[model samples]
Target: MSAVSPRPSYAAVLRIPHARRTFAAALTARLSYGVVPIAVMLCVTRATGSYAVAGVVLAVFGATVVFLSPYRAALVDRYGPRRVLLPMALLYAVLLCTLTVAGRHPGASGLLLGVIAAVTGACAPPLGPTMRTVWRELAEDRLLLQRAYSLDGVAEELLFVTGPLLVGVLVGFTAPAVGVVLGAMLMGVGTPAFVMSPAVGAMRGSGGVRKGRRASLRPGRELLPPIVVAGGVGLSLSAVDLLVVAFAGQRRLGDDTVAWVLAALSAGSAVGGLLNGAVDWRTPARVRLPFLAAGLGVTLGVAGLAPGVVTLTGAAACAGLFVAPALTTAYLIADEAAPAGFRTQAGAWVNTSVNAGSSAGAATMGLLVERLPLGVCFLVAGGVSVGAAVIAGI
Candidate 1:
């Protein structure tokens, strides 16, 4: 009789040596990402006394962060996190402090704020991709690696949710700039602790791209499928927020109802991420990618046909069941496709695709929601994911 393989669990992933400490430190710094946006937005709005200026500032900030991610990740790949991440985090923290001080007083120049915000975004450390790189280093077993990524993804999801609520609590007690200060402190403290971890130290020697391996760092055909699928998933998911709001308004649902519907989508993604990790599948991640994307696309398309809020919520949950799984698979595919010494850059590209798609999706959906029927808008969004899956599968 063949011996049975043990079922993988989140516990096993955490049990890997240094995994707990490294992940904790990474999360501590990453939570700043969740906190900084809302805090900065409110701070800018208060100082400039114009939502329009605040909006433009944030747009500039986000554009730099999203579009420049791959280059930032390359720095990590070249110098390793120890040499690169600490300086980036320190510079990022200092910039945030400068912004906080400048924005503490009213009538701060919006143009100056925009310049600062743009530089700040550019300096934002690529912690997420770096942490994922560490996970790759720590978990050599494929099955265990899957669980690690899932846990990382799920925890990240919660951190973003929690970050905003934490800022909300901070604002109740003091100014939003206080929240920005807190974000700076988190990065200052957490990043040093993360780099000191033994696991990260292990990666130091493997920093530079080996000769003849430089070409592998470039986005090749193997990397394209995951990038395409990740972008599609992001594009589809981004529309849900606006679509849900429009859906609720059309049905006269309360704000709380809208919150619950959106919450359901998050809850489903969390559950799906865990289950996806737990399964011991025979199929490769690439084979699973298209199917997962299709599942999301199909469910979201059906969601458009729901007659009531409750039914719409159910459909949204079903569609969300595939979100984390698809992204996880995409990351897995990207990791596999990337050669040694370039994992961070490879992961960053996938991350970039998701953010870029999200930006496009939001702009596209905003236009569509104003002109087209909401149901038709949802179908259009779903079609994007399905179309991506088809292209990726080919």
Candidate 2:
């Protein structure tokens, strides 16, 4: 009988030192995101007695981050992450403290909450880029980076799964403000701790500004376009995400369906990211861009069919096929586009673009959800995806 080979473990695939640190950082940051939804809802509801107001606050908060992520990223590359991280994190913690105290007055609470959200968004630290940078700096090969990002995606999904539940318990048993308190504590602990690590500070005095600025100027490079494409893709994805939940609820499916559907989406994205990482061929963005767009278009377009959970999940997977490759492509482009001095900021620009696109897609979908069928929303999202593909191909 032939001997069978055992499957390799993920850690073996990555083969990097202090990789667990990155994973730990991702966990804390993601968990912090989970806390925000609960905190915002609680803060707005207790003070204004209106869920709508609370939602608006959340939207505004997200918008601020989406808009500012690029700038913050640039700052990280220019000045090094440590300089940018501490101040922003400190500001965010301070805002949360203010929210805890100002919870009673509705007018005061709304204003404070919005300010806090904006500050938090701005100060959220350059985590995604910083983490990626760390992987690039430390990992022996591209394969390791792929594993790092895949693990990051999984960690993010877990955060969504666990963060809200913890928040619910805290709010239900104690107070919604508890979520804020917990998030702040985590942010305070996590952000600074990561920044203070010797590996991170070692890069601090290195050429952050010189490299970042050069990358920002080169338009012919791959980085700028992918970031643009990703932003649009992110927008569409966010819309589909919310629409799926809304449609499920309308069908009288339980809230539990939301988690399941989101899981499908996350699973798809993770799979796509892993697949992209595994491929060794160094394909140009122009070649890869169409596939990414087409995959998203098809996935999102089919989503409007509003099939059973199984069908919807399949569509989600199809759409997600592009997620990681597209991102990888953008990062590659950024690497090419950025001079040595501007590497980090160029990467951050890509991150910012994605956040902005997601914000736009969510807003546009919200408007559509009111007047159109859920299926129509899916079609619209798909069409937009197709358009993005065509544009990216050019």
Candidate 3:
């Protein structure tokens, strides 16, 4: 039997160059995203006046992202995340400017906004999954990779919590366009550096490892597992987003409400990831999958009972408890599942799944809100997460 190497000490784990770059990248990416919840919604609200219209606009944006993310991932795989990331980042920034300028033409605004959104969506950096791929590639120590994922979870939570509030403040105090421009600049500056870090470059150069490693990293290989897992998880996450909108719309919550609820959930997910990394649970994922399912079931089920924004956010937080760890594990699984030189595809597939799921969730919930109570929407969203957990179990 092949002996698995012993895991490294905490000190040793911290020394890995790849892990540091990932840490830096995670900080930047999440921080940039933090500004999005407020910036995007506020832009729509200011332009359209009606919350439903804003919601529809958001839904369209989500749809564009879902459809285009796979192609972006393909680029990442073909040229490396660095090669695609800078141009994509710059294009995203330009689109934000376009969205800002197109606001005055109500008749043509929606179409122009949608077009710009699609462009930005196509360029949205593949940081989350790409970073995960880098972690696996650069960190020889499994423990370090695990830590990086866990830290990433924490960073995501921080971003979601703080990002929207920052955007909200900017929109409220300054201008909606400011938020977009700033978010674009931050993303453009931060993501490219992360993608181009020395550590990430080193991993890209490992040409003659085991066949699986070579094939997974190769530019033109089909890696199906990451695609499946990413799609499933992304769909589940999208459902969660729909529920957030439902809750916000139901309570007639202001533009800031969605950001708060998402933040609450993010906090829980961050905690879960941190615990998972720290504990270094020796058990198989098969053992952990059931618990994740139960959490999803309970969290989503309770969200339906939320009577106000506070209760809704609370329930959402509970639901979030499973998010990061599940996502991180899914990335790992995708890496394991992919063939040589195809890691970027795996990451891209994950992004595509999320974008797709977000679009579907937004559309479904937006319609559902037209006919049902917010609580019911939450229940449905929660149900989606539970369903995802159950499917993962199988």
Candidate 4:
């Protein structure tokens, strides 16, 4: 056997021709993941003057887009990214434009706007997962793949933070609808470029990859365990997010400070992800995955009990450190566990599960905070983390 070469760094990884374009595309696509909510909120507020209406509208979009993913991903597998994504990207753009027009026109019906948001979002490009799939195909080694996933997690943290910041900037500089429109325009550019990339064209696929059919509607049982773990992770993350907000409110920190505090949590995660990428694990993924996940929960549980802002910051950082490693392990394992020719479906299910969990987290913690102390909300966040650990362990 030939000797193996060292895995490429994230910077070097991007220097590959197709990788650069797809990486850029993935950033925009994933950026939209966070951008859409704020954009929708701002658009609705500008048009209807009701944040409640905007929240409801955005919630509908989030709920719809997630559940529809498996089907959409199946299409990508069936027709390939070019045929499927091009149309979806076009439709998504049209919908955003339509939404902008509807919001600006007082004569436009709310029902029409809701329909636009729901359908447009449901059909949005599967940018994040698609990029992961492409990266796996392009990776030179398992270690490289793991590094790619860590880089993905890091990008996700930055995208989420940056997405809202960009939206706020757009809203300040232009009409509220401008943010949504700008997001859609970026999608229009990125999706087509990603699909048509010469690099994507050269990647080899297993002959088993084929068109999805009605009979293929259900994913293989191999996916069940990891998807459950992913959902739990998603749920725990959402709970932690809300709990942080509640913590900030309790400490008499203004809205302006909330982002600063959350930045500490995100910064820790980025560092952890970077370190994970640099290390080569000798342990089995099954053992490593659950261990990291459970360790995360334990850390979060202890941190939730912190009595002051300084303690809370340190605790959040401790919890944050585990976030990317667990996620990277889960993704790697899920890819291994996916059935033949069904990796896309498996990825979609993972996405769906996490999303479902996040929805539950928001709703569950929202209710808890209404009747229980803010500390209780933090405890619940920790509990959810533990629950994720258990599900992943099993």
RMSD each, Å: 2.1, 4.0, 5.2, 3.2
Report clash pairs, candidate 1: none
Best by lDDT: 1
What is the per-residue lDDT of model 1 for residues 1-394, given as tens digits with 9 covering 90 to 100?
A: 1222475678988999999999999999999989998999999999999999998998888899988999898888888889989999999999999999888799999999999989999999988889999999999998899989989988988898888889999999899999999999999999999999999988863545565456236798999999999999889988988899999898888998888888899889989998888887788888899999988998899999999998998988898789989989999999998878788889999999998998888889999999999889989989999998998899
TM-score, prediction 2 = 0.86
Question: Which is the better candidate, 1 or 3, if ranked by lDDT?
Answer: 1
| Least accurate 10 contiguous residues by lDDT in model 3 | 214-223
**Candidate 3: tens digits of C-alpha lDDT, residues 11-118:** 455577556655676568647666864687677777767677676666666666556655566566656766677787777777877777787444436656666766
For residues 189-308, write the lDDT of model 4, one tens digit per residue: 778778778755653333334463242337555565567667767787788788878887888888755666567778888898888787777777777766676766777778678787
For all candidates in order, the CA lDDT equals 0.89, 0.70, 0.65, 0.75
List candidate 4 stretches off by more than 4 Å: 1-6, 106-108, 203-221
Error of 2 at 147 (Å): 3.3
Models 1 onward score TM values of 0.96, 0.86, 0.77, 0.92
- Clashes in each model (backbone N, CA, C under 3 Å)? 0, 11, 12, 0
lDDT of 2 by residue, 1-394 (tens): 1122232235655455556665576467657777876776787788777778788778777777666766676677667878877788788777776666777565555766666666666666667767767666766555555555555655565576688889878877887787888888887888877787665766663444342334233345456467667776788888987898887878788877776777777777778776665555455556776678667877788778856877887777777767766766666666556665556667677777777787788889989998998888888887776777777777
The deviation in Å at residue 384 for candidate 1 is 1.1
Compared with the true structure, model 4 gives a TM-score of: 0.92
| Angstrom error at residue 5, model 3 | 14
